[model samples]
Target: MGNDGGSIPDRRDLVRTKAKAEQADKANQTRARWFFCALSKRRLEEPIVACPLGRLFNKDALLEFLLDRASYGADGAAVAGHIRSLKDVKELKLTANPATKGKGKGRGEGENEETPKFVCPLTFKEMNGAQPFAYLAPCGCVFSLSGLKSLSSAKEKEPGKEGSTTPEKDEEQLELCPQCGAKYSKSTDIIPLNPSPDDESLLRARMEAKRAAEPKKSKKRKAADPESSDPPKKKKSSPTAAPTVNPNIAATSRAVVTSLALEEAKRKAGMSDAVKSLYGDPSKPKQKETFTTMGTFTRYA
Candidate 1:
């Protein structure tokens, strides 16, 4: 008959399964031990401690654990040391999550609510109470909201009380220039008033009399001097016979002859010496010899 019980596994398979389960259990216990150690020794100052078998353990489980410890009266140096130990364990990473770090109160907090006392505006230094006043702008003025309101009320009350006793002078303060409606300060420049309209005619007459008393400038001469004049003069007649050529015409003809003579001389100089010798002397006259041509009729012989 077939066996009623299922067949048992070989030793190797059984040992492998047992080893995996034990490893999982050991990992779970290690995590539990770390958590328990963190919670139990809340007041321990050591950042890392050795167990009996020489295994190292992190005194802090996470960054938040260290931060909470710091907030609840632990010294900053102690908290920082524990955080460094947790990083050495390799199970906890030392990193910044902008969401969890700083004054942020992590996931469950309301968005619009004010941050807790751990955050300060002036230095961003964590604190547990009202922060001290620190000036943050170039104006250098520092005052709480209540102080500013008191100053404004005092200024408004001062002008009214002082104006009633000197009504005439107060009216002048209200008389702003039409061009610039700003209130006149002590630094404003004041011009003297013009005379009243009743004396307008007298003022005009005095101005006219002043103008008549002033000397007038002399007029400048426009005509030329008579002695130094050089108008068209008549040429004197000569006792000798007048030249056939008018003097002006003769002068123009001489200029033309000079230019022609210079151009001919230049042309002769430009010729080769051999070619110039063939043409004979240019400055003196040369006799001309004529050559005659004969015409004849010829028959093919």
Candidate 2:
């Protein structure tokens, strides 16, 4: 429709224009996760350790966070407070990428950067968190999950190999590490790096259950280690224990006790006969209430 004495308004002209905000760059986000400490946000360096949640951190940064949690502020505590000690994290045995090793390193340089600091020896894929990665608990060797499966599949394909036969469901089947040839259990050793929230919860539950099942030697450790053990309890002496003798006295303890009894008797014997009569003879049975009755003290009306 034509506007009276004016140009017809187009849909674009009618709608108010709004500037769209730029979203975060995916490449930068990926690089931040793969190359920086999740806690300290500094460039990742050795000796690096990964949490049960799969996030990576510098060992020194974790130590500092543990030592003074308040310094990192609230977010740091929430990010790493789950890490109570060094035992909570395992040091990763990472293979340096040969492509990047020979080149000089510079901080904050863009694609000008040569390569990812580390890579999977099996697939040669850079550990940039683009794909799944895992580390073995026993050997601490890291490898991409796809590479591990490929190696496993390759073994199974070998003719007459035991892996080619039916797999065993043994609770503790020891598998050799492809990288180091170290023995590890497949069911428990393979820990995913930087796992998703759901996977992290499962890993955390498994960790807690395993720890709870573990034979707690902390009580024993405290008892055995002198520095950690409580001070030895002292033996309590009885009140009637062997009479103590004055160090300056030449007489024995028994002699001192005997002398004290004799003196007490003599002092009583020296009491006047009238004063002594107030107390009846010890040989006679004591009256129920010579001076006062224990009950019914109110006088009869």
Candidate 3:
């Protein structure tokens, strides 16, 4: 009778409903990612920075965590361990939302504190974790993905535009930031802020690729710079002797050093008993350096 008319709910059905109720609300989690510091869980303030994985954080909070990772408890390393230093993050340049500019709510004003403080300059869309947003690496200017895509498509629509030979090369196209006139490479310079896990993997791949290319570039620079090509030579000077002309060093420096050294030797050689007691005899020659005593300090014989 219960199976035919559902007079009583089964224990399995009850458990399933309970499990569904216990599931985490993803909307609040998404909002928290956009509005709070990833490390401190504090409301994000100015001078906000984003890591390569697209997690947001307050710069000060991240700095404190980097200074003493253990201070934030056992979870500190898990939160911001990727950020070894301030250089690991990019300071985001966010556009302030105009809607709440003059109407800033104070204590007891009944205005929701959850109101977004930033907006996309191109689309005027609030950056409340609803729309996908990205920042230009070259300029650090933030914008909504929709706004940026629309602008790019419109710009590329130009008839007979240079570098638009094929529509398939859209990702490789270059575009100027709408908020700032800085030119950014579409394929590389646009970094999504608070990107999803799938998108983060893609960003991570690009980051590693760029870093892999860096050493190659440094090697080329070292090869190109003639001075850096040769290893540095150690300057060797004898206390009693003058240095000969050295092409690697300036003649003036060598002459000054030689004159100073000669004067010191002469003065020491002429020292009286009282003054000479502390110094080694200048007339006697030092023993030749042996393999065993090569680095040992020697006295005049």
lDDT of each: 0.35, 0.73, 0.76
lDDT of 2 by residue, 177-267 (tens): 9999998887877899878778889888988777655524673565546534333311122222323334335466668888987965775
Clashing pairs in 1: none
Off by over 4 Å in 1: 1-6, 32-301
Q: What is residue 172's positional error in candidate 2, in angstroms?
A: 3.2
Candidate 2 clash pair list: 54-194
Give me the candidate number with maximum lDDT.
3
TM-score head-to-head 1 vs 2, winner? 2
Alpha carbon lDDT of residue 168, candidate 2? Answer: 73
lDDT of 3: 0.76
Evaluate residue 272 in candidate 1 and report its C-alpha lDDT on the 0 to 100 scale.
68
**Model 3: per-residue Cα lDDT over 1-301, one tens digit each:** 3567766887988898887765545677887889888888988898998887778899898889988988677777877776668777889999898766767654344364667889999999999998999988887888999999998877788665564477656666667788878888987888898898889889888877876687458756876464454332222333222244453356777788999889768876776764454344454323322333323422331
TM-score, candidate number 1: 0.16
TM-score for each predicted model, relative to the true structure = 0.16, 0.63, 0.63
Model 2: how far residue 107 lies from native, Å:
12
Rank by lDDT (best first): 3, 2, 1
Model 1, CA-based lDDT: 0.35
